[model samples]
Target: MVESLPQTRSVSAEAAAENRAWVSDLSSTGDRRELASRRLYDVLLRAARSEAGRRAARLRLAGPELDDIAHQAAADALLAICGKVETFRGDCKFTTWAYKFVIFDVGAKVNRHFWQRAGVAFDEEDWERLPARLGVGPEAHAESRDLMAAVRRAVDETLTAKQRTVFVALVLNGMPTDVLAEQLGATQNAIYKTMFDARRKLRTALIAAGYLQEHQPA
Candidate 1:
């Protein structure tokens, strides 16, 4: 008898068929691949532009700057999609899957653009926002202040220099992981690992100080 297993979600028949066509055309040789590549790039470009439009105001990008970022994101996404096309599993529509690549590229580009235009610095305002961001309110203002103090001490005393820098920039200043990686000449995975370690250390410190429960997930 066959053992029962968890069922995996599958795309609709129409989505599956479209996905197959995209994979096939992109994987084929010569003229067919060229035409498919153009079509795919257009799709990626539109997705990139849409995301760029959403982020432009916040990032202070406009006109040529916005267009440049969108175009570059589309180009990068196209390359990424081509390399990973074979990995497509059709759990969603091909366009939906493809759109993720462009969106991520746009975010990375926008972040990099911000850093290039105005570099990040340690700001008291950003630090002040942290307590409020953590849901600390006037109801328990005194207790919240204590928690913030404990967190500050943990950040300064417990974490390593690299960990402290990463946590402050990423968690406090809202720097993107990709931009941080570029600035520090580290891999995105490395930055993420450091952030994870920093958070764990802070959680442990908070727990020891009676600010958090031992069973709580960081």
Candidate 2:
């Protein structure tokens, strides 16, 4: 059994065969690679459109604009996937892994679209969202003000400048990770990882400073 994959959702033999064929065709030379790429591009386009469809209403982008986002996402995903073809290990289905690429591009595109639609700029004013998440209340912690102050310091002093920017933009300003990534000229994966590290640092600082109540995961 693959430790990373649950046995419950086993990849059937037929599915595995198809995945292998995708790899073979995609990794082929000349015309084969071209044809395979076109096929994969179509699949990616559909996946991106589906992704956009799921969020069109929330992003308030529909009709041609949403389709345009999906098209751009598919093109981006195709380039990324083809450029990194050697990295496909076949641990998961080819389609499954490729889907992630499409999702990443689509997510970034959608996030930027949403941000543009909402006019959410990352500013000092956005920091307002952090304080509420940090403090419980006057009754929960007598030194709520100090705890909040400590959290602010932790945010400023503990995280790297980039980390601080990403966290503040995404959390406080309600800017999506993808949009923050675009503004920072970074990938969504990189921004998310930075956010993860920043959150861990903040959690430790908050717990140490007597702000958040720590509870072990069950």
**TM values, all candidates:** 0.62, 0.56
**Steric collisions counted per model:** 0, 0
lDDT of each: 0.77, 0.72
Q: Highest TM-score: which candidate?
A: 1
Candidate with maximal lDDT: 1
lDDT of 2 by residue, 115-188 (tens): 45533343343444456554444454466557556867897789987776676667664676656876668999
Candidate 1 total steric clashes: 0
Quote the positional error of residue 45 for candidate 2 in Å: 1.3
Over 4 Å off in model 2, which ranges? 1-10, 117-169, 172-182, 186-218
Quote the positional error of residue 213 for candidate 1 in Å: 23
